[model samples]
Structure formats: structure tokens, C-alpha cells
Target: MILPALLGLGTGLSLIVAIGAQNAFVLRQGIRRQHVLPVVLICGLTDALLEVLGVAGIGLVVERAPTLIEAIRWGGVLFLLWYAWGAVRRAMRPEALAAAQGSEASLKRTVLACLALTYLNPHVYLDTMVLMGSIGNAQGDPGRWWFALGGALASLGWFALLGYGARGLTRFFATPRSWQILEWCVAAIMVVIAARLAFGGIEV
Candidate 1:
């Protein structure tokens, strides 16, 4: 039981630790001290819900539906490109840290973008629903549920850390140059991810 849970924890961490669109957004919000709570909450909770459904076998149905994945792929690509453009535009301004934070993202807008980033990407589905699902189900019976729990906890813990712990770098990001660098990095990530989403095909 404990072993399965530990396995789940490690697996979940491995999946979530990667610096992708979602993490980049969360880190940016954290550094800016803007709507970090809701951002992390939505990300963590969404992952938990998706993992639960995956462990229960929705992944199989999703795997069977190529059309659904196709829709997500195009949508993700467009959305990511739009997001990347925004980052690039922001980077062009190169304002002071306080000036940059002056126009903080609204909660509603932030939440919606967070949701879009989480759900639009096909890799999220692959990582959570298919890959994590297969592993969690392999734990067998009650162990599977325990595995889900561990994974959920991992999601929550990681997002919380990413959202709050980012403040440690606040001083560094206080300078506009540093902030511009971060935004450029974020834009690059978004473009790369968008390219992959556009060109890559989902394999079950």
C-alpha cells in the first residue's frame, strides 16, 4: 500500500516537474505576485481530477477518440502561439519591475488562461490520463486509489511550491532586465511547445 503510494508520488513529481507552459505561467504569476493562489489551485485541482478519471479508465476512451485529440492539438497550438506573442510584446516594453506589475492580470482572466494552458495541451492528457493512468491502474484494486491519492498530493505540493516559493526570486526579478529575460524565456517555451503540438501526433 505504502509502496504504491510512494511510487505514485515519485511518478507524479517526475511528470509535473518539467518546465512547460503551465509551470512557466505559474512561475511568472508567482514572481509578479499576481493571482498566484487561484492559479495554483486551479492547476493542482485540475490535475487531481484528471488523474482520478484517468485511474478509473477514462484514458482508454480518450485514447480511442482521435478526433478529440485533434481538436485539442489545433486549439493548443493556436492558444500557445497567441500566448507567446503576448510574452514577446511584453518583453519588448522592458519596464521596471513595479511598472510591469502595475497592470496585473485580472483573476478571471488569469483563471481562464490557467485552465486553457492546462487543458489545451495534448501532452497534459497523455501525461495524466494515459501514462499516469496505466501506471496507477497497475497498482491494482485499493492500491490504485491509494496511488491516485499520492499523485493528487504530489500535484498539490508541487504547484504550491511553484506558486509561493517563486517569491524567493522576487528581488532578482525586481529589475526590468531580469523580468524581460524571464518573459523571453517563457515566450520561447510557448513557441517550442506550440510547434510540437502542431507537428506531433498523439499516439493513444
Candidate 2:
């Protein structure tokens, strides 16, 4: 039991630690101190839902649905490419980026934006449901839930820490040069991930 719980914890923490769009949004929100709780809650809940789906045999379904998977794969690739372009454009136009330093968008708009950002990439479900679920299944039934729980906990813990901690780094990220460098790095990462997803062979 302990071993399964530890395994789940490790697996969950490892997968969620990657710098994905959700994490990026959390970081930006932390810096701005805007809609932090809602963002964190949405991310955590979304993760939990996907993790449950994964453990409930959705992973197997995804594995067998090659056409659906392929469609999602291409869609994810396109979205990443589009996001990368936006990041590059923002980096190029520092003034435009700075202009929105203090967004006054309504809470409803913020929530919706967070939801769209969280759910837009179909790969997110693939990663959590298919990949993580398959991993949990290896531990057998009783242990599987424990593993899912561990992963879900990791999602909550990591996002909360990241979103809140980034607030302290706002000073460092304030400079135009800093934004430019960060945006460029984000663009590079997005492009690389997109390429990998589009061209790399399936491992799981």
C-alpha cells in the first residue's frame, strides 16, 4: 500500500512538473495576483476529473481510438503553434504587452479564459486520462485509486505553490527585456513540444 501510494505520488509529481500552458497561466496569474484562487481551483479540479477518467479505463479507450487520437494530436499541434506565435508577437511588441499590465476583465471572463486555456488542448486529457490512468492500472485496482489520489494531490500542491510564489518574482519580471526573454523561451518550448507531439512516435 505504501509502495503504491509512493509510486502514485512520484508519478503524479513528475508529470505535473512539466512547464505546460496551465502552469504558464498559473505563473502569470501569480505574478499579477489576479484571480489566483479560481485559477488554482479550476486547474486542480480539472486534473482530478481527468485523473479519475484515466483510472476508470478511459486510457484504454483512447489507446484503441487511433483516429480520434490522431485528430486530437493534430489539433494540439496547431494550438501550440498558434500560442507560440502569440508569445512571439507579444515579445516583439513589449508596449502592447505592458499596456495590459492591469487587466480589468470581469471575473466571469477570467474564469472562462482559464477554463478555455485549461481545456483547449485535448492533449491534456490524453496525458492525464490515458497516460496517468494506464500507469495507475499497473498497480492493480485498490492501489489504482491511491495512485490517482496522489497525482491529484500533486496537481493541487504544485499549482498552488507556483501561482502564489510567482508573486514575489514580479519585480524581476517587470522589465521589458525580462518579458522578452521569457516570452522567447516560452515560444521555443511551445514549438519544440508541438513538434515532438506531431512527429514523435508514441511510447505509451
Predicted structure with the largest TM-score when compared to the true one: 1
**TM agreement with the true structure for every prediction:** 0.96, 0.86
Residue 118 of model 1, lDDT score: 93
Total residue pair clashes for candidate 1 = 0
State the lDDT of candidate 1 residue by residue for 34-69, as single tens digits. Answer: 999999999899888888899999988888889999
lDDT of 1: 0.89
Q: In model 2, which regions exceed 4 Å deviation?
A: 105-113, 120-123
Across 89-162, the per-residue lDDT of candidate 2 in tens digits comes to 98999886666665554779778767866776566777788888988999897999988888888888888999
Best by lDDT: 1
**Residue-level lDDT for 42 in candidate 1:** 91
In candidate 1, how many Å is residue 187 off? 0.3
Candidate 1 stretches with Cα past 4 Å from truth are 96-98
lDDT of each: 0.89, 0.81
